[model samples]
Target: MGIFEYAPAPESRAVVDIKPSYDLFIGGEFVPATGGVFKSVNPATEEVLAEIGLASDADVDRAVAAARTAYERVWSRMPGAERGKYLFRIARIIQERARELAVLESIDNGKPIRETRDVDVPLVAAHFFHYAGWADKLEYAGYGPNPRPLGVAAQVIPWNFPLLMLAWKIAPALACGNTVVLKPAETTPLTALLFAEICRQAELPAGVVNIVTGAGETGARLVAHPGVDKVAFTGSTAVGRSIARAVAGTDKKLTLELGGKAANIVFDDAPIDQAVEGIVDSIFFNQGQVCCAGSRLLVQESIQDELLDALRRRMGTLRLGDPLDKNTDVGAINSAEQLARITELTAAGEAEGAERWSPACELPAQGFWFAPTIFTNVSATHRIAREEIFGPVLSVLTFRTPDEAIAKANNTPYGLSAGVWTEKGSRILSMAKRLRAGVVWANTFNKFDPASPFGGYKESGYGREGGLQGLEAYLDV
Candidate 1:
């Protein structure tokens, strides 16, 4: 659909009262951090949205101390059912203020309002709700007769899906009876700070969930804090390695959900139009900031020309503009730095002999933006095929057989997720089993659920996030 097909209906920013400055949420209160202050920018307009407090080493100490005290005296000591009630309250509050939160997320994180409202916010609530039911039923969760909370959990989340990633970390940790000290990415901290208010509204006790906001330094201190018993991080692989080294000899139980260069394999018998839509949704959703985005397209040689033609036509219809607009399909890049990385990699793809192609789309000149792009004639050795672009850029390579597709898909060191598009049930099963990925989608991509486990293998990091299995990440048997 073109922009003219649907009249422009932008969601109201008036719903969100963006404060001039925000403080660290620690001990169930908004406290000042000693780590100085920084501005959080709206990537869509390059506007200064809010002044965010940076968390210093001492701030990390204070936050971890608060979490430890809470885990020691209050949260972990509370009955599981009571903890569950608190979780349920937070979930309801999220739904109640969904519009406000979605608006804030769009401006701060640069994802479209349609996505923030429909996917991110809803899934965040679902995560909290899913974990709440498990609060009183940990015993039956197959962990043990009595799985214990892992004390204070230090969680660090990335910028791509800020609020949703917070839900993935905090909900289960709290539901499992652990107190948390969370550090949201510096670039997108508004929704997380708003979530702190939701905790207060839910009457969650002081020191149970603390948020310390800053850049990489803040996250580093949080993960390395001595009082923390468990560490869960979601970001880049290089950062994941540093965390692994930091917590290597310590007793801290750690789970890392890092990067991916996933493959979306399309077969000759697959539904062409349907696969094209899935492919677009896979890479272009959230401006392709997803960790498990289908950046690599492995199509059967017989259907290559047919699929590419349809895919190009579909890409042309993708509307790129204001994030708050309901009609927009692609939004701004998260930051200038991230846009630079995408630009450098896409340029590399072309330099390495890949044919670069993008629909005729004009980007707003004010803020960070990269047009939705794809590279054809890409080889296995091309940098674009091997590395995670983490943007709306797809690399297309052809395969003649299922085995070739499998080999091409698993060629990368990062095996977080993959998609198989085929009509044959037997082919789906066979390909899914053979693909070296943590999550395999038979006929779809980018589908997530609170009940299903999501994580990756290889350098994509260790451990699962959303499911009964995720409980173990925060509990001690």
Candidate 2:
């Protein structure tokens, strides 16, 4: 069947006001970078949205100094109830400006409007709301009778789910009474900049939350800064390793949420219809730009053919186009560089003798886009099966028994997340127990809640980032 075309139902760009240029938000104000500035462009149209300052070593030092000052003078001295009030205000403000922020996120980050609006924005607010409640109640959280804040926290987040990741890093740090110097990904700094505005609206104290925008060099400086008491990072495993090395032998507290190559195992007893939907949402959500995206699909040998047929039909129905479009199921890749990486890996899959298939979808002329792709007849030894493809690509492998499925699923260096689809409750429990992943979803996939702790095992990095456990990363007993 041929692909169907739809008229552009683009969300209004008027919802967001893009400034000509943005400065680093430090000590409660936007200031020029010591290093020069760079432009953040819309990956969907290759249009320059705004120019953002690149933080140099001096800039990082200034931001960290500001955070340290705030930690010592303001945030740490404030009462927990007062801190909760500020977080509550920030949460309310985020909810109020959700639409504007969502539109801006769609433009700046190239995620579909539906995602920024429906999934990302909502979660950002929820994290604040959830963590806000924990502020005054930390005495009961089991860390200690009076857990102390970790002072100045240095956080570096990734481009995918920019605002959501910022929320993940910032909310817990703030709720635990720690001041923060956050560095958003270079390509997606607008929403974090917008978040700075929200902080102003919430009347957060000066230097309590600073955002220094730049790339890896900037992040390196922030991590290495002596004033930073704790460091949290979410990015590539290689970078995570570097941050660990940089902070080694220091008293700096560190948490790293890195890469994943999660397995989605389907047994013959699974309801094919629901499993197909779960599979689609698992990898295709966020254009497969998720850290724990289910890139490996493991099917029982008896049901592999039927499940594959169903999966192909469903993949065909996905709509890929303008990110601002309200109906877009898959949006543009975040950047040209990311597109090149996805291309290189998929080419390797094809060259390595796996059967590659993609839905009949037309990519946009301008911007980075990859059709939803699947590689069948995949082996555990294949790069596509073992490596983290961080794109809309899936590697399909078949197993003959429950033992084989478990073996294949747990054969990776990464143990971030995994999924199992089966009607047998006993099997689900057994498999869930056996899977080495931090999160296991049975008959479902890709679910997240602020009340639940989320992180990974092994090379996927360390330290939990949500729920009560999240606060532990920012506290001292």
Candidate 3:
């Protein structure tokens, strides 16, 4: 029997009413592709949720041609205020359909319904709304006397935060008067397709926003297509490097928001209970599929044992099951491949002499599931400590001082984000300055706002994704 067999299936009528077979959204219409079709599975139950068109090279060409034509004839020439109005319309439509979108996101992407409803969907709408305000105010964004749009942007987003990432990519591109051909990751493509419909509902211009769904091959074709003027990606560090090489000599402007193994540092002066909560939320939210998850927990030696005991006790209480449940704290792993990767890395941590611990809880049999795991006594050289596990796995390492903690946190090549927990305000500021990350959260972890700029430093990839900085990625300054 499957894990879900022990409980009643959650309500799915909101997702069921929507058509499951989706095609390429091109020229403001959903049209069948001339190539192949693939089925998208629900990770929670290993059930087929939908069949989506897999774009062929020819289909990519057609989409690019349409985007280019739109850029040259309609999009680029559109007034900034008009572009702003269109984004506002889309944002309003998203707000109207927020519940439906949340339900679909939970079903298609395996994120908890509470998070999809309260966090992802709301933030997705807010991102569009915030960037909409920036459309006509380019001059105020400190870009110089004038800013011009990049002709056509090709974006490929990851599965972790599907619709939200799509919003981050598309809203700014469209607000800057650039047409886009976006490819959503294969594992979670339905929300992008649904957003395409929302665009149609808002009467967005034909070819202004096109979504092509497929795996890596389609994304590569979209990014490397000669007609595309810009490329934006959010995924693994390995693929980000490949994309950098792929676009190397081309004039295609590139922005990559790649992988991260962020560190959450808890000093001796920190409020242990609050710090523990933030640490738990940082690493376990989205089942730790988040790239910016605080997978590395650095605690002061004085409180390491106390914090670990508290964390283990808290993790033991977390309920993991159907994503659509209003009460579920942890959901199924996104895919079988992801589960295997987590399993492999967890074993590596144990092999390398780190002690592994998981809560005594039952996992669902049907879907890809992993218990929230932590590795104590982890060294910086352990594969589990160094690699991006991309699951609800935390590696605990102790530090003796603030300088040591900062050194240990910045030890990795990734500099996307980090967190510091302390009651000392001066220490927070000092540590934030010394840390070489793009985003530093003081006394908190994993907080996001549409008004805040977000991205990475070093190998975590370049360019900003939110706030005023995001508009620059789509514009020629």
Candidate 4:
């Protein structure tokens, strides 16, 4: 399908109706939890899509126990090539149901359908296909000979890219022969529940992959559960640290892909229009909910004014409303809580004396929304410049030279990704080498491929996903 075909619609009362009372997937079957049930809301309209069973501490234990049993009896002992076939089957199924997943994802997560269809669904499939090939070729991976599977993996993903993040977590774990008990973010559990159906369609072994839906407390239960052999998390830095501390005394391996305040540096020698487009995609795509968003723009002093003008023009042209529309560029903020957080952080930026500018745009009533905001004259120490606002907010800071740009870019605790906009190949290589991030895009931003290893340095969290290195996270070296 074409990219433009997935544009989002404006706000309307129309809602995606999800089945009520989704059960936890345990032992390859949909089963009710012993705990209470909770409803997941569509952030765009505040409509409940599904009532999901909230897994209690005991439920998490049961899920982990089931995973451990599956790991020992079936999944771990399965032939590697057979496991690859199962993954391939699941990928194909995902592609078949791509549109449904896209619509459901947009309804549940409040991201534009274009992103859900073009980016999230496709990448989810590609991730599965990519890792499926690795299942039968473990010896070729950089990990040492006779790599063994980690037992039961407890994975918790964020709300931003629910199903895609679930794919990233489960594909590699299954490929490495580890059974998974995944917990999707409470605000967006529909897609993950739908994914459990896909697993069933693939006839995956019972207990091979379980989906537990709940809030932070349930996630803590799953992660801190004694039966979990490893924990893979993608969320905020604070929660990542907590999970790190939770697993400190245990032998459980941990892989965290946390928050980022990436720098998108535009050099004087860069292609201005292209760099502007890259900057827009970096910060504005996914309504700036992306963890590795290029929230900080460090432009060369020579081209700061021109780049800022172009960026503003681009931001002004963005259509904001209706995640399901076929024309929307920006969608609603995920939830009111997140919008409040963005507002608070932006207020801090203004209070800290950074110049804030947002295009004069009308936001729909009755839905959580934030205009695309840009802060100029932002210093390294500015609260907005230093902290991760995590909405469609960008902080523009200037640097006079290459060294200064690199220094300013790496000043933050985040090192997830960086964007260097330059025409000169030598400059791109040099600046990329100096940037302390995992993924560096020379002329682009937020480009993801299943074959590329992706993660971060410093507080952005550890462990790579999507490449051969991703397999290492699930395998015992």
Candidate 5:
């Protein structure tokens, strides 16, 4: 059967008001940074979206101080129900401004509008609403009688799910009554900056939430500052290590969510069609920028041939183009550096003797992009199988038994997440229990919820980021 063609259905970017230059959001106000400014670009067309303030050492210190002041005076002392009210307002504002946030996200982050609008933006609001309900009910969260707020929290988020990660860190912290100083990734700061406006609209107090923007040095300064009572970060494992070394022996409490090379294990008995769809969404969703993306596909040897055929056919149909286009299934990569990384890793796969395959797809002339790629004949030691490519690249390996599948899937240095596809109930339970990953999805992939706790074991980083346990990250137990 031939694939159907669809005309371009671009989303209107008119909803977004891209400021030519944006300032640092500090202490309930948008203030100029003491450091130099940096330009943010639309990765889809390589257009300069806006210039953003780069937070200096002094700027980080000031933001931290502002959070401390807010924590000690207003935010920490505010009644839990009152705090919930503010979170409720922020959640509502996010809903009202959903289209605006979604358009800006697609423009600034180079992700498909379908993703920013349907998945990322809604989850952003859902997180706030979920945590808002918990704000007034901390005592019932099973964290003992009176869990006190840890005061100022220093949070750093990655670019992949800019606003969603912010909500993940900020929501629970706020629910537990901790004021925060957050640093959004330098490349994708627009949505976070807009979120600052939401705070203002919600009448959230100054210093309650401060957003600083800069590169690694700024993040290092923010996390290492003595004024911050707690630290939460979601990014690469290398940076997580640096933050860990910095926080070691300090009084500050810390939580980190880092890299992953998750395995999507498909058994012979699994529903072939459903598994194929799950596999595609696992890696290609968000252009495979997800940390817990199923980069490694382990298929049962018995059905390996059948599964690959279906998966490739599905890959061929994925649309890749302008992120503003609703029809574009795969969009531009987040940045040039990220594109280079993906390019290099895929090259390594070819060199390492893994059979590389990608459907014939035309890439846009400008901006960073990668065609959805897969590798068969991949050995356990292949770099593509072992490394976290963090792009729409999947490496396939075949396994004979359930035990072998578990062994191959657990071989990675990462233990962030994994998926098991099977019809047998006992096999699913057995495989899930044996998998070393922190999250195991049976018969599904890339599914998330605000109520479910998510994190990783081993090098993928420590502690949880959702549910009641997430609340503990910001509390003094």
Candidate 6:
């Protein structure tokens, strides 16, 4: 029998009906934007998906005013049990429309359908579900005998994991009795707008949860808005710094979940097969756009060659093409601008004497796509190893000792996440204590749950986003 190619099994685009032009979801309804509209394209095909309205400073001000009004007149005055019920409704609605949302997320954000279905959408629902339970139990949540909500929260989420990041920002804020004005990333606003419909479906009060779509200026206006009591952001570290400076003199409570160049350390004694899979999932999942992605690989010197061989073999099998395909592993880059950043960083890695290798994977000609790439002979000083590439690119740097691995892993300005692969339980515990990152994955990589608190130390940004710790960010102690 002759070998055959796999037939295309694309998911139907009809699953999500993209509107001709979307307006800002402010107060209680979809309102027109003062700023002009922009097109959101399917990164996999460069096809225009929908026209998204951009929010100017005036729109942001209006949204914040709505949030404040809702917080004072409705959401804040509502009983805890009632608030919990509303969140529960939102969670149930999200689960009900998960398929539609996942397909839309894949189209608008360029993540594989597999991820949007299994990871993003599920986590979005899980965050609401988890925070709902906390809503009625806030008295015992360890904050204080009486905790109060911040009046209005200004939340800005990144394009990567658009809906999931919104859940991270909004669920806890709402659960804690604060109304929110959320800004989804410019490249991906469809899901957040869809979430606005979800709020209406839940019969959530007008202005309880408003979504204003735009670029950085919109976010800047939101965070700096005097009426906003809290500000939360998830994106680049440089932008996080800018937000920090923007709200410096203000009373806005800030929590930033920013960029990372997390180190994935592999010891010689680690289970090689599992370690290889962890390495792939760490950097390749979501096309490595994850804020806590393990972009830096520190393999023990004795196992470097063996680990690299396994990693290369694994990378070869990752299917990169249509994000809507059920079998696709890697998806298109989120945008042209982000692709250029990845390209520049990777080229610098090559120019600085690092050896780069990529599996022979074909990419679509029309879209922004970068293949699963790895660089050997990488040093701690190399730009690819040190900087946040935020793409499916890994820098392999070998370490001979556990102390050296720890040293190299904490060398960066980012301390969001790290993974340690080892068979020794004692060593894992010891190293976990030593690692400066906020979240550490032992034996596995990129695992997240609603019960666990997630955030980072140092420049990776501050404040927890899950579990009981997350509640404090939106609460007044």
> CA lDDT of each candidate?
0.94, 0.93, 0.91, 0.90, 0.94, 0.93
lDDT of 6 at 317: 79
Give lDDT: candidate 4, residue 114: 80
Runs in model 6 with CA error above 4 Å? 1-5
User: Which digits, one per residue and each the tens of the lDDT, describe model 2 over residues 1-477?
Assistant: 555767778899897889999999999998999799999999999988888999888888889889988889999999999999999999999999999999999888888999889999999999999999999999999998989998999999999989999999999999999999999998999999999999998889999999999988999989998888999999999999999999999999999999999999999999999999999989999999999999999999999899999999999889998989998999999999999999999999988999999988888899889999999978789889888888999999999988998999999999999999999999999999999998999899999999999999999999999999999999997
Q: Per-residue CA lDDT of candidate 3, range 9-83, in tens? A: 465655445576888988888889877899899999999987899899988998999898889999899888999
Per-residue alpha-carbon lDDT of candidate 4 for residues 1-477, written as tens digits (9 for 90 to 100): 422333334433244447877999888888888788988877778877778898888888888989999999999999899999999999999999888888889998889888887999999999999989999999889788789998999999999999989989999999999999999998888889999999999999899998887899999999989899999999999999999999998999999999999999998989999999999999999999999999999999988889888988878788888888868888888888999999999999999899989997888886899999999988899889888889999999999999999899999999999999887999999999999998999899999999998999999999999889899999989
lDDT of 2: 0.93
Q: Candidate 1, residues 80-147: lDDT per residue as tens digits?
A: 99999999999999999999999999999999999999999999999999999999999999999999
Candidate 5 C-alpha lDDT tens digits along 210-251: 999999999999988988889999999999999999999999
* Model 1 pairs in collision: none
User: What is candidate 3's CA lDDT for residue 38?
Assistant: 94
Clash totals, every prediction: 0, 0, 1, 6, 0, 0
Residue 83, candidate 4: how far off, in angstroms?
0.6
Off by over 4 Å in 3: 1-12
Regions of candidate 5 where Cα sits further than 4 Å from its true position: none
Better of 2 and 3 by TM-score: 2
Worst 10 residues of 3 by lDDT: 1-10
Point out the higher-scoring one by lDDT: 1 or 5.
1
